[model samples]
Target: MRCVVLPGVYPPQEDTLLLAAALRRERLPPAARVLDVGTGSGALAVAAARHGAAEVTAVDVCGRAVLTARLNGLLAGCRIRTVRGDLLCPVAGERFDLVVANPPYVPTPPAPRPSRGIARTSDGGEDGRTVLDRLCAEVPAALRPSGVLLLVHSALCGVRPTLALLAAAGLRAEVADRALVPLGPETRSRAGWLLRRGLLAPGQEKEELVVIRAERV
Candidate 1:
């Protein structure tokens, strides 16, 4: 069986694992220079390398996640450069032909599992716009002209609002792909948590997983 990524230092979540599976089923164009932001388990990064991306840089905010990405790269026999810093922080002055982010878009508090690395922002923080705001701003600088940016995140994390933010950041955005999947345990629990805080609908967890595609203008 072909795996999207060989096992990494940190176990991959179901969505990311599924994302890799989906990517493997597609054929990217030639000489793609790829960057995988928030690269927790290095699944997408390794996928780019294994499938022949000319350049691959995998970065994450968590120090441990970097180690995991490195280990995963090694185990998979793919030479991916792993860095530690907050979204695009380590790669300042660098650019890529394709940028991928599975950010902490989960609109949850800081109580999420430290090791899951889902990229949760502050307290689901007022319409869940925290991390997406930063990412929308940061992505354009890193994207090469004609480069594509792919962001995988949730509907409840405010995809519409995020699209607006991306436009304000001077990037053209579209929903290139979408999926409906089981919310992770923490995201599933967001209903009660948000309700206690006087937010959320009864069935908000049945949310869309959007793949926001972007390009530098």
Candidate 2:
């Protein structure tokens, strides 16, 4: 899908495509409602809509991303409801049959100043779980019974913890898809920091991106 990502809005990347591919393989319920958290360019939202979602709602914390997603949805001939809010806050108390997310998962050093602009797209705190942990805790609440969530993140963020958190939330979670890709610019820039933190081995040039499928049953 061709999406117009405005300046500062995150463009769809490997993780987004990985999650989208998982979404395509999922058996969505009839007239399923879908939610795309951290919608960014709305690529996943558009994908969900095209994949037969009856209604698609996309949420993003960045205003630019919201606009970019909304515009992309229109361009793609998909009706995506884009909202600007943190994580699932915009859709509180709403349940969806499917949810997808490709949040910031790159491990970044602790800076005196918080990440801003496009940096926010991949700034996953010191351990890279800051946002991922929050998503694991919050997504279950937004899912309907039998609902499925497809989330993509780097292994550096600790997949086990994500599974544990989802399990603790009463969801059945498993690694659904994975790919070994060269480190993205964001991750590459932090290779030294990741190595120091033991998240990356010396000279490890590739990062494994994992797509986790969690079902609320």
Candidate 3:
């Protein structure tokens, strides 16, 4: 797909493609509403639109990301409503048939998350569930009954907890997909901290990526 990714906006990566593939497997109604949270370049939004979602909305906190997603949607010839705000904040009181997210799941040290810059795209709190947890908690409210949520994150962040949270939110959740990928730049930079925290073993260079599928039943 042709996409315009500006500086500081995240480019499509493994997790993005994984979530997109999982998205295609979903059975979307003809006029289904789709929400792509933390949509970096609108790749998943475009995919959802292409797969028959009548209304697709992409949300991001970064200005560059918002522009990039809008541009990519235009370039892809898909109609995507792009909004700039924190995850799910812009779409209050709205509901969707499908919600997709590939949020920041990298385990960084506990500290105030960056308010701007590229770091904001990948910095998750200490255990790496900062954004993931919030998404799991808030997304259920945005999902219509029988709606589905597809989220991608690293196994290092703990898949079971995510499942538990989603289940606690009344969604029937399960691991839909998994893949082992080599650590990227951000993960490599935090290798020492991760090792010290016992989140990673010495010489470990790969992490498992997991896609959690939850349905509001």
Candidate 4:
């Protein structure tokens, strides 16, 4: 399949398509401004454009990924404003009515994988909650009053704790979708072993992606 990320950058464009597709089907209000965090290959930004969002802002920490996202936006005929900065760093002065993030949720490092963004961010930190924690805290500030924030993360990555954290952050969250997939031998060997031993069940090759939307209250 054609990769979504630019050559040599990682996080093939195909990686974000599933979540991007889901965002495309959303019914947005008039002239809604949407922000996509961790926009590795610009998949979500392009998808937001396709979904009829009036303004789309996509950000990534890696410069190569930012350039790739810009090119993808151009190729897709979308005017996604690409920003080179860490999460919420570049877009400090902006707020969006709708925000979507496929942030580096994967906290665990990949087992010699081709792309790092897809697998590495999969580590949620110790209990797979690091990235989610930042989202829970920063997302609210990045969203407009009454804005909607959509987040997709692994259930094995402390999904319940993530929900609780969101609530504590003053955002009311509700699950939107979930999917489970099997783990690879290498990952199952490295991270999965700890998870399988009655622990946090992290690093599972077969795991669920829980789609959740929280409104800034």
Candidate 5:
């Protein structure tokens, strides 16, 4: 699908593609309600809409991302509701048949989150679970009975913790797909820090990105 990604907005990458593939495997009824949290460029939202989802709501905290997503949706010929808010805030009190997210999961040094620039798109705090943890914790509240969430993050963030968190949140969660890709520039620059944090082994250059499927049971 064609998408217009502004400079500050994250462009679709491998993780996005993986999530889209996983989304295709799900059975989205024609009237299914879908939500794409952190919908960078609205790729997943449009994909969900194209896959027969009747309604798609996309949320992002970045103003540029919100506009970019809206434009991308128009370009893709899908009607997507784009909202600007952190994580699930914009969709409060709403339940969705399907939820998708590709939140920041990179293990970065402890520091105040940047107000503008690429850090906001990739930094996920020390353990790389800052954003992911919140997503796992709050998703249960937004998911209808039997609704599914498709989330993607790197294994460096600890996949088991994510699973345990979702399980504790009353959702049945498991890794549905995985891809071993070379570390990107950001990760490569933090190689030493990741090594010190025991997240990356010595000489380890590849990271496994996992697509997790969690269902409200």
Candidate 6:
């Protein structure tokens, strides 16, 4: 699907495609509701709508991203509710049958949280679990019974920890899919730092991206 990404919004990348492919494999129930957290370009949101979701909500902290998602959804002839807020905040008290996220998971050197622009798309903090951890903690509460959460992140971010966290949250979690993708610009830019931190090996140009599926049974 074509998306009109705004200047500062994050365009669809390999991670986005991975998560969307996983979403397509899901057996969404009739009248299923789906939530796309960090819907930068609304790619996943559009995918969900086209996948037969009864209602799709796309959320992002960036205003431009939210606008981009709305426009893309309209262009795709999909009815999507777009909201600008931190992950899952705007949908507080709401529940969905499926929640999809391709949040920031690139490990960055210690620095203040990004408040704007494209940096927000890949600034996953030092250990790269910043947003992933929060998603594990909060997504379960946002899911209806039998709901599923499909999240994609780099292996450098500690896949086991994500599974453990989701398990501790009372969800059945497992690695649903994985791919070795060449490091993107953001990851390549921090390759040296990642190697120093042992998150990357010497001359490692490819990173493993995993799609984790957690179901609230």
Model 6 lDDT vs. the true structure?
Answer: 0.95
lDDT of all the models against the reference?
A: 0.71, 0.91, 0.94, 0.71, 0.92, 0.95
- TM-score of every prediction relative to native: 0.81, 0.97, 0.98, 0.82, 0.97, 0.99
Error of 3 at 214 (Å): 0.2
**lDDT of the structure predicted as candidate 4:** 0.71
Candidate 3 is scored at a TM of: 0.98
Q: What is the lDDT of residue 190 in candidate 1?
A: 66
Give the per-residue lDDT digits (tens) of candidate 1, residues 1-217. 1223323233466557656654554456677788988787788898888878988999876676788788778888899998887788888999788887776666665454444334332234445666678888888888777777787777776678778878887789888778887767666656677666554566655557778877778
Candidate 4 lDDT over 1-217, as tens digits, reads: 2335655454632235546656766778889999988877777888788888999998877777889889888888889898888788888878898888875554454244334444443444555566678878888887777888888766656678778888888888888777765653323644544555454354334756677888878
lDDT of 5 by residue, 1-217 (tens): 7678899888999999999999999997658999999998899999999899999999999999999999989998889999999999888999999999999999999888888767789999888999999998899999988999999999998999999999999999999999999898789988998899888999997999999999999
Runs in model 3 lying further than 4 Å from the true structure: none
Please report how far candidate 5 places residue 125 from its true position, in Å.
Answer: 0.6
Question: Per-residue alpha-carbon lDDT of model 2 for 18-55, expressed as tens digits?
Answer: 89899999988898999999999999999999999999
Q: lDDT (0-100) at residue 151 of candidate 1?
A: 78
